[model samples]
Target chain A: MDDLHSPDPTEQSWGSLLRTNREEVLEKWTQTAAANLGGRMTPAEMGRDVDEIYSALVRADTGDQIDIRSAAYADLRSLLTELSRTRARQGFSPTETAVGVYALKDAVLEILEAHGDLPGYRAFARLSRIVDDLGMFMLETYATTREAVIAEQAEALLELSTPVVKLWDGIVALPLVGTLDSARTQVVMEALLQTLVDTGSEHAIIDITGVPAVDTQVAQHLLKTVQAARLLGAECIISGIRPQIAQTVVALGIEFGDIHTKASLADAILLAMRRSGLDVVKSR
Target chain B: MDRIPILRIGDVLLVSIQIDLQDQTALALQDDLSSKIVETGAKGVLIDISALEIVDSFIGRMISTTAAVSRVLDAETVVVGMQPAVAITLVELGLTLDGVRTALDVDRGLALLSSALGKAGSDVEVDDLAHE
Candidate 1:
């Protein structure tokens, strides 16, 4: 423990040591990082990213205590954040992105081995801690960026899933695929209602053929949507309820009330057309 | 209290609510509507609430009561021009307004009212013939 706090005779700091051997450390760091990244980035691009990070790190060293959360390391942390965010968006794994920072430890270790001095070993210990901190920081930023990407994809999927197709002059059909959650139901309701007002359609058909199952909550959402459409003076017909779903609905004792339901989308569309005062006859 | 105007369009009474209705104003409108229906002997009532952005339970109850009062006076009530947001709000608030009929807009409301009254007129005629 006493050896841990032993003062350097020459009073050398990691920052100055890094500066003296900056060219060697940076080249080795970039090379190791490039190899770790599996040639995903060009040599010039990787060199530029590492050069920016190296400059910020050199400036970030205030004293022996390298607290990454300090004001001095703020710039370095921001640079890491930007680098990790881009890597995350580029479909790089968390370990892969973080390994890029950890590569610096190996680069510094090689330099420390060449020096083979007692104070150089102590400085390397502190340097390795800072590298570990930066690696963890990159991991956190990567996680958050991946989370943001996932959230954006979910919103886009919600938009793409609910489409209100115009079946006839005064009829619209909403073909719902996948499971029905409250958030999805709200989107479907708003879109269907807006379309109704836009087209002035008197009849709407909600087809759930792509929907896998129907539970009590799903049934409740359907009822609310139908009631909302009815309040807008548009009749709603629920279609594409499979035989299994029908059994599940009845077994659960969920009352659909007066909302018209059909077995298939075609049947629902036919009902909507007939209600809109149109009849389809086979052409002889 | 501000009174909601009741316009006579042939046999259907059109009440276009263009203001944010307070409780007292809603009550006054209900009173005025009932009196107008009786005076004109209208066969149907169309309430256009498109301009109303905010509708609380008080206004919702007033609309239902107005429909009930119109029904008692031998007139069908068709509420029209309810905005999508307002309709969603009403449903979320559990005010389905089951007994009252609804239409997309004033024109559709008029058509629905006319057709409904036409059916009622023919049924009354059949009853008169039976009585004879």
Candidate 2:
């Protein structure tokens, strides 16, 4: 009979098991850790921490418990917070911090899973805050980026001498100042259209006098605006066609025959008055 | 993919089109928008396409159709934020938009509509004068 005290090579200590079967132990630990951290960490943080913990668990051996109770986890939390603040101060994109938070959460979860115990609720709470902060940071950064892009794009497209102003009669004048490209054309179209509806104006003067030139594309867009105005029974009078623009129009051989174009903004206002047949001229 | 949010400012309903207005989404949006316009009894509908990068033929047709339908419902339709490239592309593609009001933005579109409505009211006086 074998001696009762005989040691079996297969029944090794935790440390030896980790060393000899690192891959298998790590895999098992990762799954356990993720499960343990489930609902305790944000998705992003969990993802990050999972990788870290997996590495830590692979290094752990028999007689070694996954010690998330140590000050290391708290230090990690503080480090992440500092990193977030530092990144914010540096104006580095929040995405970077979000990525870091996710990694930390993942590592914590993995450690817990390998140990088959849960982190303290306080630790979980800290993780949650990190995730939330990162989410907000990312969202705000995205919104700012989006607004900046929109403003830049709109400025480029609209090319108006006066982008914004208020009128006493509530009739705002948006004098387009440069070439109308497809993107900017859309911005102008939308701005004018929305202005009409919002202000309930009887007339809108799109003075293109400052526009360098006109092509068939520009002409068509102008026509579309006119047609759109008529749909709402609103009249959009195109004004400010510099000689160069007129020459370009004629050169392109595009017909403004069906559309209304005025040599000047004054002409456009007069045309609008005539079209509306409003005799606003006061009698002395 | 689901319900599109339509914002109402005064008598005008501002519908911001951020997602791709294509196929089922277009049809769904049209149906939903038409019903909302009728229900809200809005005077005008402004389609804000500042977020859209592309406007296909189907979408263009839908816009025109929506405007026409809105008119029948006594609500005017205005399309705003049509990028110049989109305008050029649409024209080159031979897509015709009839009965759809357009402006540079929502504010201008509202002003134009108000002025047009005001003119319509005054036109009644003109008609009365002509009859006299």
Candidate 3:
């Protein structure tokens, strides 16, 4: 491409020009992005996202070091990280987020033409390499940050799902609502035990009214939790066993083996209270 | 030489593990504790592991074995003062130590022992008679 276009002074000339002409670059870049990748977003929002990346690119290029791992690129990485996080939360598709960087190619090309000092295809090629790298960077950042976001949300959901609410003095209720997985089972057992230790509770009612089904695997997970609780000196009452679940347990011949079973959360609560030596009396 | 000392406080046997139990020490402790249970005829056994910062499958098995042996001797075993981390590790290691009773501290463990033995004094005979 160098043979196709005229030569510029240096290899990094385009990068330097992009730095000096950031306003022009950003302005053109916004137009290109808003027109192509805006989807339901306003140009102002497009401008807000493009500006951070535009300035980052300028800083990265204008610095003495312009490599991917350079300290100069730190702001650029963080800007990409911020942009990726927001894009993910906004539910923008991955292509849309990457397009926010990719679409700048045409704008920069036009900017090069308007300046009449357009770097030769060689310089433009180098510039394209950097821009393409930045575009890919956005996608990679989006994927990584999205994974972290998912992990954090999973942890939050785990904590939320296994709430150990103290029903009475020396009685705790763990109302489980969702499909039980091994990861979630660990969280449930830990939270239940910690709560038991904290409250000195003697009984834990594991109410599974919100659980949709109970298979052999779910049964095993439940038993492991019950066994762990028993080891800690707290008896677990498996409650909310719907008629269908009861039939399934019989069909499977899975023995709960002396662990108390109840038909409803109410029954479990009553039993927990009674066993803990508390009487539920009506107040005047 | 590395036997875990078994102290008899009244009719209960208290074994506090103050050091990390090597494989040999754990085995020796298991042997010594079981014999002491039979020799002293203690109605309760309290194994306090508060000072132990770590427990592997071997250590866990030793505890389970000691509890089982104590059972044959007709004494209730209560493991007490397990640090929160140790408890979590034990669970994660898949060592529930099912036959063993657990308590938050030694005092609570002792109280549990008395009540358990009190139950054993009456209910255990019924279990024996039922078996017979």
Candidate 4:
């Protein structure tokens, strides 16, 4: 009959058996600790702790008589929980929180190592569940914060604005200075069109020397706004064609033949004046 | 996204366009631009493209259509802030837009409108001279 209380000589040398068992215990403890501590422990630190626990377990030997099982598992769990709470308050990242949980797993493993033949395996199993729960909680909390940060940034970008100028005779001039997006595009369109009606201007000028580049979508939006303006009996004049923009238009194969274009706002104004039948020399 | 006023420059309204103009936003923007044009009696409309990175076929068509509509209303349409890379990409993609005026910058566009207004005034002067 196999003896349950004593180490088996054929199964493993005493020292080797103790060493292997200690390692398994320490591994479990470190995992548990990592989970309970909100996974904030680093892998290097956890490794050191595992080594220390293994050495301690291997050195303790009571043969077949001593009961090495203790309530150390519960103690380790509480300690890890405190550590996790502290780390959470400090705003640890998800990776760091995961490390804390692993630390607790290591501690639990150490306890198991000391009670290799004990009947308290059931208790250790229960402790495993607690470690898992802590890990999940940390992950959920981290995700929520990350999402909130993204939303805040998007809202901030939407609130930005720029200044513009309008001529008394019904021409509007918008000097674009920075980057543009669909959201900003919509805002610019509404403001300009509304200004057109409010001002009763028949002409509008858009100078883009400050604009860095144009995408296909942006080009299309400009087209849409122009068409929309036509419905209201207004005309759009485009000016300030930097050499780069001209080249880009040519390369893209987008034809602006029918659309009115000028090298500068001065040229656009001349065209608008000619169409309106007003001479700048006489008006001044 | 709801249409919001981004900025005002002279009699030209500069609006930041969100929502795909080819989708629901196009019709909404059309309606809004039409009403604003009537309400403001704006001389011109400048569409800023610094924000849009991609222009699809439907969007291109809508832009052309907007220009036509604006012309019927007696308003001019100008498209501004077209990135060179985007222009190249669109052309390579085989997208073509017609009847839409383009400006490199807002100042030049406004100047064009100003000149148009000046010309209209001259035409009025000519009419007066003819009558006298």
Candidate 5:
């Protein structure tokens, strides 16, 4: 909306006149922010943040600067980004942050109305559009940053959940305890294969005793894990074949091929020990 | 013409494939191994493929053929020292190399051969005892 070479006289004068009532607009903006902020922040901190953006806008000679994407609003864009990220980290909602920007329209309009020598209708339209654009930028940045934070947290949680343990000499156990998905399956396979190499174990017992249910995808993931173990010359024995799971497996007609499956972890471990040439004799 | 050398170690012919195998080299190794097993009358063949990072279908088929040919000649073939990445890739390639037996390393492969030999020795002892 602004022309750098041919400055609109009315637009230039509006910006010049705006500086005269800067203190009054700053006061009203902080009051509206304090009222809307609702105890989340002290009035002093809220006032300080609003003061910085207000001076930048007035100095940018934001008369007729309606288009936020234009070079004229570059400083405003960066300022809003910093504000949105800080508020996102502070656990403030997007609407709350956007409303802080939106509340500016009322404060500025009131200040201009009291000055009787207001700009023409065209200049007023440009000022209103600028505030609207700033509000939209704040909401957009808040949403995008919040989603990124959630995704990072999920990845960290996945790493924590998958754990590989060496159960005995020449034997390792991967006790799975949640719903299996492709992403988690990749982690499980890599962990199991690495431990198999580290321990040089001949047999690995994958106990899914804590697994909630099974489906075609889960079965496929399990098969991939078993196949990978076998490639390393380590035999895989699936444990926790509960009757319900057995029924589901049979109903699905899923053939496990030559991969071993046992009814319980104890049975699987015993089989693994036997294959590793351990004879567990009962003490009489 | 990178011919993978086949060495006769006692009753087992040890072949370590330590090259980026071309199709001809793999086929030549298969032919050389089969003839060596027959000429030495070796009871077992140990193939150390730890250096074979990629096992494409042609190389895979050559190994399977060698195993089949040796089995017909009363010899057992065990491929050993396969890397974990190669194994995972081979499985993904849908070539499990099912017809052949495998071991983690040369030591385990030797142990596997000796244990079977030991079992054969006991069978002979039992036969002599039965005759007596």
Candidate 6:
């Protein structure tokens, strides 16, 4: 009974069985995934992703063992990873991205059910195992892709937050607006110091009004920044010290050591101007 | 055995250290600077370290000591043009060089020195008036 159309299920590998029904399986898989995604992706894009994965799966010679991590499935695994990365970048949920691979199981099962025999049922089970491994792989890829996206955004946020603004001639100001961790403080310190040299500004104001809390560690960071600026021969004035922050600084026994602290940015600018020998007088 | 040259501009003694200072060289420079400050009767001392890229803790201490010696001689000391990396390294080493003033460059250093001299002159005048 070695017929091309009706080969014995036990004698045929799942790869060959899959190849024989590739068109039907791909169409069914794409349709199910499209419904699951609520049509967020166009049909052409969905079809292309499904087509790539199906071709790679049919080419993989799983034989008896169904390890997706095996060398036999390397091509298939990479194809699935690529699909998941695209889905993740498009903002698809984990379940939605993984379901694209899982849908192949139902499509294969439908084809096996049409045969209606015990051997056909056994073949479906083996294929089902391979599909399960692939779905998990897709899920793992999705997680890593999302994590990469988050890390890139966090770095961008750090850059956007710390801006060394030139307030006036011989005066620059850094408006701090977040938690002062060691990493952020290091970035802030370097940027301020570089600006001090580039602009030849003798006075700098660090406005901490947006800083929500002041622990000993944060106070230490501020002191380090001011000291670094002083090394460049630029004086730094810490401004926007709300009453609460002042109390916290005193309570924590953090000695700013003669570094000027002002109540507001405006006051800090006024002091910086006075030190630079400039006075603002209103003209009538 | 090379000695760092000490240049005098107006009332400011300019010590531009261009070489990586050895311990003996630093000691010799310190001696020469102090004697020159006395001989010239300079009002301010400007140390341009922009050419120096590397400094150990010994050199850091030498700078502070030089400033102290200048201060005792009735001259203000200003360290100018310290590189950012050098500044960070010094801070990390915990050498803050307390009591030594800093400027961005020799131009700024001269300005700082003159302004300081101006203030000191006015303070002397006030003291004279108080004595009267």
Which candidate achieves the best lDDT against the true structure? 1
Write out the backbone clash pairs for model 6.
none
Stronger candidate by TM-score (4 vs 5): 5
The number of the candidate with the highest TM-score is 1
| Better model by DockQ: candidate 3 vs candidate 6 | 6
TM-score per candidate, in order?
0.87, 0.37, 0.74, 0.43, 0.84, 0.82
What shift in Å separates residue B59 of candidate 5 from its native position after superposition?
A: 3.5
**How far off is residue A280 in model 6, in Å?**
13
DockQ of 3: 0.24
Candidate 5 C-alpha lDDT tens digits along B3-103: 99999999999999998789999888888988888899999988888788887777777776877888788887787777777776666667677767777
**CA lDDT of each prediction against the hidden true structure:** 0.85, 0.58, 0.77, 0.58, 0.77, 0.84
Q: Write the per-residue lDDT of candidate 3 for residues A92-192, one digit (tens) a residue.
A: 78888888888778877886677645343445667787778877888988888788889999989987888789888878888889999999988888888
Model 2 regions lying over 4 Å from their true place: A1-258, A261-284, B114-119, B122-132
Q: Residue A175 in candidate 6 has what lDDT?
A: 98
Q: What's the DockQ for every one of the candidates? A: 0.39, 0.04, 0.24, 0.05, 0.25, 0.40
Off by over 4 Å in 3: A1-29, A37-41, A44-82, A89-91, A107-129, A248-253, A277-284, B1-5, B81-88, B91-94, B98-132
List runs of model 5 lying over 4 Å from the truth.
A1-18, A62-72, A110-121, A278-284, B117-132
How well is each residue in B1-132 modelled by candidate 1, as lDDT tens digits?
688889998898999999999999998888898999899999889999989889888788788888889999988999998888888888988898888889899988887777677655643542343223
Task: Candidate 2: give its CA RMSD in angstroms.
Answer: 17.4
Can you write out model 1's per-residue Cα lDDT over A1-284, one digit (the tens) per residue?
A: 12222364645577766777899999999999899888898878889988998999988877676889899999999999999999999999998899778988899889878865776676778888999999999999999999999999999999999899998898999999999999999999999999998899988999999999999999999999899888889889899999999999999999998678889888777767655542121110
Chain B TM (all candidates) = 0.88, 0.83, 0.87, 0.72, 0.86, 0.89
Give candidate 6 regions above 4 Å deviation.
Answer: A1-11, A20-24, A42-48, A62-75, A109-129, A278-284, B20-24, B35-43, B72-74, B118-132
List the candidates ranked by lDDT, beginning with the highest. Answer: 1, 6, 5, 3, 2, 4
At residue A135, candidate 5 shows an lDDT of 93
- Model 2 over residues A1-284: C-alpha lDDT tens digits? 12122165223233332344345544543444345444444555444454453344333321323343344344434444454554455454555435543443444445445653222333334444544654454445545555666787767655543363333243445687777776776666667656665565656777887777788888877777655544443555567888887887888898865456778877666565554443342110
When summed lDDT is taken over every stretch of 10 residues in candidate 2 chain A, the lowest stretch is A1-10
TM-score of 4: 0.43
Q: What local lDDT does model 3 show for residue A231?
A: 62
